[model samples]
Target: MLKGLVIVCANGCFSSMTEANSKVKALLAGRKARQCCELLVLESALGKGGAPWDFQRGSDFSNVDPFAFIVLA
Candidate 1:
């Protein structure tokens, strides 16, 4: 891993151990409430207002949702 490859954010990242731990707990506690919402967000089937997997069919995000892709170390 690289030194400057880590990023800290409100949703929780490697910036703080406490916040990062909390984020993990949330995920493990079946707090995946955003699963459906996230899938729909990436769906360009209806211009980002549809429902499905990510927009990898040569399309752009219709409604850009502030998303953060995190990796735990």
Candidate 2:
């Protein structure tokens, strides 16, 4: 069973978070309580090892883009 939804944004931007949150909420509208899951947002630096997964060398997130997030359920 899904208990939560996590949004991991590459850059910590308020606008990005807000947009993602709204999208998630819209998607969950009209769902039953049990079907709906808690939402969480996390800020990370993808090229700086902020994420647990490994990335290839030379990857650049120097200028992190807006609204770049990974959804985990």
Candidate 3:
């Protein structure tokens, strides 16, 4: 099985880690993918150096497609 911690972040921002994790889990609750991946949230506001608020700034996905599929080793 492909089990890993899927760290999710918003194009905007989330206030807390708990809130981010819960919201993502709730959104994916009905999906089978949720069963294999452990959901996590990147608390941009609390991280070191912080994260960019604008999606176009300091973001790798700024010019990419709307969806992404990542696998962690």
Candidate 4:
């Protein structure tokens, strides 16, 4: 099966690690992105809840399309 993978910027900078973390939180918080291909916040998501799901970063997440995964960080 093909799983969806997204790259979230959570380093605070645009497309950074901070942004990635935020996007993930937004999604989990029920804040859907209004923009198409909106940048994801990966850090915030990881902050809110420990990864009970099978989500991986820098390995399975890298090299994949950002929109492909539903990250909540």
Candidate 5:
């Protein structure tokens, strides 16, 4: 089966990580994008220690597009 992947950006300059997370969900639900199994956040959003937010919730999101993640940088 073909899985999907999405590159979500969160510079934290204009948008917050939470907003970026919302955007990622939007992209997954977007019609143009493919079936995303993973959602990678930019380095700026995820700090070195990965403090701030827990993107782990996305793992069980809908489960319609396979698995997902917010890879720690």
Candidate 6:
């Protein structure tokens, strides 16, 4: 299932992480050299204005990093 999804995304049905990362890297590289860093926002398919995941709350989140948020709206 994961392989199928990745293949679809790679075929342009959706944007994959590799594409997003490259785009972000290029954008940041062009910014002012003096700046330490900058932020680049990308829409997520899982939690960005979408249904919640199977394990999105309470103890389920305990096994996951706080920064690794699902895109549930």
Question: Top model by lDDT, which number?
Answer: 2
After superposition, which runs of candidate 3 have C-alpha atoms over 4 Å from their true positions? 8-12, 44-73
- What tens-digit string does per-residue lDDT give for candidate 5 at 1-73? 4364445343343245666666667656865444535555542434233333345644646533222234443
TM-score of each: 0.22, 0.42, 0.40, 0.23, 0.34, 0.30
**Number of the candidate with higher TM-score, 3 or 4:** 3
lDDT of each: 0.38, 0.57, 0.52, 0.42, 0.46, 0.39
Among these predictions, the greatest TM-score belongs to 2
lDDT of 1 by residue, 6-34 (tens): 22343322455555656554544554443
Q: What is the model-wide C-alpha lDDT for candidate 2? A: 0.57
- Predicted candidate 6 versus true structure: per-residue lDDT over 9-65, tens digit per residue: 112323555565565566457435316544443333333333344555535755443
Each candidate's number of clashing pairs is 0, 0, 0, 38, 4, 3
Candidate 6: the clashing residue pairs are 47-71, 47-72, 48-71
The whole-model C-alpha lDDT of candidate 3 against the native structure comes to 0.52
lDDT of 2 by residue, 5-55 (tens): 776655535456667677667766775843767878765544333534335
Query: Stretches of candidate 4 above 4 Å error?
Result: 1-14, 30-73
lDDT of 2 at 6: 70
Order the numbered candidates by TM-score, best leading. 2, 3, 5, 6, 4, 1
* Tens digits of per-residue lDDT for model 4, 10-55: 2233455555455465665543433334443343333233333345
- In model 5, state the lDDT of residue 51: 31
Evaluated at residue 48, the lDDT of candidate 6 is 37
Number of colliding residue pairs in model 5: 4
Superior candidate under TM-score, 4 versus 5 = 5
Model 1 spans with C-alpha error above 4 angstroms: 1-12, 31-73
Task: Report the C-alpha displacement of residue 24, candidate 4, in angstroms.
Answer: 0.8
